[model samples]
Target: MLKKGQFKNAVKMNNIEKYFGHTAALKGVNFGVGANEVVGLVGDNGAGKSTLIKIITGVFPPTNGEIYIRDKKVSLRNYNVKQAYKLGIEAVYQDKSLGEKQDLWRNFFIGRQITDRLGFIKVREEKEIARKIMFDMIGFRGVGISAESKANKLSGGERQGIAIGRAMYFDADLIILDEPTSALSLKEVQKVLNFVRKIKESGKACIYISHILSDVYEISDKLIILDRGKVVATIKKSEVTLKKLSEFMLKYAHAK
Candidate 1:
């Protein structure tokens, strides 16, 4: 439990709700993620997963809710994508975050470049920094991969690695990953899971969204199960096995 006047979660939402026209997307949902924790968000399609994430990332304001980032309440009216970045929240959506044609170095600093006093991009500095991020930060030692490598030339897993490393390099407090392991091969899935472990090792929090329960079982400290716009279950990794969790979801789906 969180105490009064004490910071606990990296991000928290209280009674979150979202409405579209007369229909409700989210219904009084409560959620949170703590530092050094990996949370798996698992749910069926149209379960309001995307809607909830959008609200948290400041893509849109909630119809009714309070959001606290690092224990500080956010001003909904002023919260935007730029504000979310400023507050140390970043999202990495599968296949949508990177520029396929851009070099690795360029992708790393695409929107937020390192510039001199006169607003000139420091190309050499950016390349060196990108190298550290790729090689040291995310441990991307894949053969034939370098700072100058174009994103489109890399595999899906490699592209995800670069995106994740870039988020970490920027010092984001809470990183949200949407469908990170979708359509990945077994080896590539393992690679992505390893990258997620890096986030936990660095004492940063991650909200991992994926349909693969096995992958979630392997890395997540907690599992949040959502259904029809509500958080129905929050299971700790210790309390259940992969098989039991799967069975529970199947049963829950049928019951609903």
Candidate 2:
């Protein structure tokens, strides 16, 4: 059972709108993501998914309407990437936001870290944390690369593991993943899907934005279809058939 203020849904957008100069990107968009639930956001190339994510992450404020976290209405003004972290809202974009030359531990605690008494950086502590996070939080049990393996040296699947592990280590209540498995092989895609499922089992909400309907059906607990800056439907995973979801995505693509 979820408490009223606890926000089973970590994010709620009511009539969200975004305008760049004079062009409108989103118009009266509304959506919600529940706790421990994997909600799939499916649409064509320019269905306002990125805009919506930017709004939720405080990259930009909505031109109109309300945005809430844990049911508390909040202003997005002055809220930057760091603020988003404090709010327990983390976004893992398709571009893999890890430092290529930096090791896994360095990338994991790049922006945030624990320091020693004299304000010296604590490398050992960070590595320990990273190791624990990779194994416990993300269920990654692959090659025993020292925490010092460069991120670029990691394979596609391994890099993804590092990214997801970082997000989980931050104790993020809501994670927004944008095309996480877009560049991976079939086997690697399955590995990423397994990590997503683990995220839900750990009782955190995840918004998976993907163009792949099959992936969505395989891993999502709910589906939210967005078309031309508006939400077309929000359906339960059990209630939606793969054929129905594919049809919805196709219709949305054609409508755009």
Candidate 3:
């Protein structure tokens, strides 16, 4: 639960529009993620989900619209990954951003490394913290993995867990996940999904984007359906059955 004065919405995008030359990717997309809410973005391929996420993360600026972080309007003139990270917005994609050759601790702090006053890396501290984050925050129950284990050596689900844990460790207010369970075995998918529950339990919000409607139905508190670059409907999970949500998506799906 949020203490007395915390902002209600972690992020709010008003009339977000994205264009690729003559093509319109997102048309006036208005969305918000409240604290501790897990919102699922479900749509067929090419329904503008990626475009909207790109705009949110500063990979591409919206052609027109306003974005607010913690209820304060932010100008997009200098929007970039650095600014996004500074604002506590983190993303975990299916590609698993860890360096294959690097160990777990190194991958955990790949871009943002802890350093001493003289610029020497605090390797020991980083390893301990990484171990705790993976074992505790991500619920890695097996306990065989070590901080020295290479990223490539872990299973796909375990790597995804590490990435999510890194986001939590950094105190991200809203974590965007782009198909984090793609192409994984059933067991691996379950493991990755469990970590998302961990995120919700931590009182942080998440924007989960995926084509897997079943996984979305199992986890999301609310569901947003997009068709042809526009939001078709926003339904609370409690308000409808999974079969109904699937029907809605199917009914609105169209070829671009």
Identify the candidate with maximal TM-score. Answer: 3
The C-alpha local distance difference test score for the whole of candidate 3 amounts to 0.88
lDDT of 1 by residue, 154-250 (tens): 7788888888888899988888988887868888888889889998998899999988889988999999998888999999999999999999888
TM-score of each: 0.94, 0.93, 0.96
State, as a TM-score between 0 and 1, how close model 3 is to the true structure.
Answer: 0.96
lDDT of 2 at 81: 68
Task: Record all residue pairs in model 3 with backbone atoms less than 3 Å apart, i.e. clashing.
Answer: none
User: Clash totals for all models, in order?
Assistant: 0, 1, 0
User: Which residue pairs collide, candidate 2?
Assistant: 8-35
| lDDT by residue (tens digit), candidate 3, 1-256 | 7677588898899998888998998998888888889999988888899888888888879999999987789889998888988998999986559899889899999888999999999999999999899887787776568888998888889898888998999999989999888878899999988988999999999999988899998999999888878988888999999888888888876756
* Structure candidate 1, residue pairs in collision: none
Cα miss at 110, model 3 (Å)? 0.9
Residue ranges of candidate 3 with Cα displaced over 4 Å: 1-5
* Candidate-wise lDDT, in order: 0.88, 0.83, 0.88
**Count of backbone collisions in candidate 1:** 0
Q: Which ten residues in a row have the lowest lDDT in candidate 2?
A: 247-256
User: What stretches of model 2 exceed 4 Å from their correct place?
Assistant: 1-5
Those runs of model 1 whose alpha carbons end farther than 4 Å from true positions after fitting are 1-7, 254-256
